[model samples]
Target: MREVVRAASLLIVLCSAFISSALAAGRILPHAPQIAFVSAFNNSANLYLLDIRHGALRPLTQLPSLQRGPVWSNDGLRLVYESNAGNNNINLFMIDVRGGPSAERQLTYFSFDEVEALFMPNRGQTPEGFVFTTVRGPNGDIFMLDVPPVGENNRPEL
Candidate 1:
């Protein structure tokens, strides 16, 4: 009887520890909306949030667009993707990685817009910001923009 009681106590203690740890993490995740995108239907991509607690899925983008590649910001607060939404060419857009519609902010708009900014981890962020390549006449040019602090949006400081 004593051995059985000890086993039961150990089980209860372990279970309690797990429950508390889970609850603490749950409370902290909502602040970011936690999201991931997947192919929901034919030729379309949709984002879903893992409830983490219930394992429930939530929809993000609904309209059909050639969505592929998910890139996260250094801070993990933003996601950049390529999609066919208004422009005929591939464009770069940023979104809140957490959840919701997370409207994309277009990074470039051109007749043959190509997102030249995303270079993955290898493309080191310079003292300014991201180094970019833009077409000029028949040749392509390389440029750099210093990363600015929040609330300082203006034409690239060049």
Candidate 2:
């Protein structure tokens, strides 16, 4: 039964190819999530992601301005931080880790200085927005802004 043997071998080869392609396409399994952080690099501060499993570091933000106080969302999908890029005051910004550096969005349009921002999780433990201290005139007050989660098409409203 040489024909029967050849047919079985061909079937096995096609199955193996399909399985290999599916795995390589990232459809069968996905990469583990990583942690994001901010650090000084090349004389300027920027954001970086740390792959804790393999100790690999990936640069997420490569701006010339100072990026600091990065706080990850409750779901670990986005980051909110303060940046002084092209502004006289430090303002809050949000960036998606999956969308790369161009995905950075300015959340605050005011001239006030915002600092120490952090994501506040809701009762269900999902990130609602961020709370930070802003300096208005001679006093600093804590402010909150509710924003849509990252990757959504909606723009954040103050």
Candidate 3:
């Protein structure tokens, strides 16, 4: 009986800790603006955000390079995507969802192309980072990038 009681108490404590942590993470916006999905027309593609609630559309990226595969950050405040950058080399870049002077920044500058990037979903697993496929000739491998924390004005430690 004592063993069972102790087990039950431990379970209750663990469950409560999980619940509180989740609550502390705060709530995701019910209708945050969605990702920019470029549409193909006349062989042209550009980033655009669509607000389904109000049937509104806004252009987010206007660059000559081909942009594709946009993934939102865990906080939903930023977006990371791939751009060819007219150098025949695809690289990763980020943009703030909200318009501002510090809206855009190039995240990766590499001769080898990186694509299909995805932000780590679990905050605990990757405090600030993402993973993607790096293409190098006939060989390809998965790589992880640890992003710098916001508002720190410091470079990523590679």
Candidate 4:
């Protein structure tokens, strides 16, 4: 009877510690906006969108590879990221946030890795696209890519 009581007490203490640590890590507020982040599972990293207000999580990518550095366009309609798919060279890919994984389009096919992508603002008479750094040697090179129109999946001209 004493052993049973001790086991129950240990279980309760463990549960309490877990809950305390989770709370200390910070909770998503009920009114918080949605956010996109990457999480790794089973040796693969994928993108996910969290609806903070409702605490709903939706995966944005299901590829069996590493995807990271997601950045939103100025209008928030699309996201560009880097993925090490097809030969393990991290290249840029874009997807319409509302269209899910089926709308993902490859944006770069360079031999080296392209990362740190960000959308350039389209001010009055300015062209809009994303700029990224290509990792080759000790120092990487920055390149700008023009975004094609929606529904066009062809690779953008350099």
Candidate 5:
């Protein structure tokens, strides 16, 4: 009975922490009324969209990897986030919110972790893409990746 009680207590504490963190990390889209967030309610952390007015919840990602730092594009048509999908190192990925899971595209392929991604505003003399930090050494390096144009074959340029 004591062991059961301890386990339940620990679960409650963990669940509370998770909920708090998720709520704190929620980001509202710039051009839309929906908010993007990460949640582990389905056992694995994945991106989700919450309709602010209607209170509708939609899961954006269903992969068995941890997704974090969801940032909306300038136009709010897409989202960029970090995910540890293929390996232990986290990489940046972009997905069209309306395109569903199939629209997800891996942005960085480095062995080190890339995180804290955000889309750059389209302005004079500024390229269109997102900026992210790469954890390579003692200090994290910031990089700006240009958005690749989709080729005629319907694939992103490498």
Candidate 6:
């Protein structure tokens, strides 16, 4: 009976260890997805992900310039931010928070110089999307960048 009890305790311990390791391995850079507001306008403002698993900071943009005024996607899977670099163009860019390569391949082009961006959900049968604000003289106008749903299995779809 003592041997049997010892064997059961050993089995439980091994199972617990295996479960812990499995959970650890499954945790990638982000155990939970995060988006941050950065100071890229003057002091190297860029979006950063607080990777809980790696315990490190990850920048969303690959650009060598400054970025700011980030707007996260409706589903919280992606972000679109503004970058100026003291140039005439203030381009919009999108990146994934999960820290892999950005699924969308192109940077959004705006004819007007942009200053900030935001995303609003279409909660009442409106099909959610995003909005961006760009400076036109002293006034800034907010515009929409409509996008299709990620579709089907929707694992935190963005």
* Candidate number achieving the greatest TM-score relative to the actual structure: 5
Q: Residue by residue across 53-90, what tens digits does model 3's lDDT show? A: 34455767777667777777877787788888768898
In the range 1-158, model 4's lDDT, one tens digit per residue, is: 67445544544553465453231111122233555666666667787765544546677888898888788777666678889877789989887768744678888887788888978877844446778888897878888888877666666544
Q: Model 2: runs farther than 4 Å from truth?
A: 1-33, 100-102, 125-127, 149-158
What's the best-to-worst order under TM-score?
5, 4, 3, 2, 6, 1
- Using all chains and alpha carbons, the TM-scores for the candidates as numbered come to 0.49, 0.68, 0.70, 0.73, 0.76, 0.56
Worst 10-residue lDDT window for candidate 2 reads 21-30
Query: How does model 6 fare in lDDT?
Result: 0.53
Q: Which model is ahead, 3 or 5, in terms of lDDT?
A: 5
Give the number of the best model, judged by lDDT: 5
Q: What is the C-alpha lDDT of each candidate?
A: 0.48, 0.67, 0.66, 0.69, 0.74, 0.53
Tell me the spans in candidate 3 whose CA falls farther than 4 Å from its real position: 1-35, 41-43, 124-127, 151-158
> Tens digit of lDDT per residue, candidate 5, span 40-107?
76567888887654556788888988898998887787888999999999988888888743577887
- Model 6 C-alpha RMSD vs. true structure (Å) is 13.6
Clashing pairs for predicted structure model 2, backbone only: none
* TM value for model 2: 0.68
RMSD of 3: 14.2
Cα error of candidate 4 at position 112, Å = 0.7
lDDT of 2 by residue, 37-65 (tens): 55554667777775544545577778999
Candidate scoring better on TM-score of 2 and 4: 4
- lDDT ranking of the models: 5, 4, 2, 3, 6, 1
lDDT of 4: 0.69
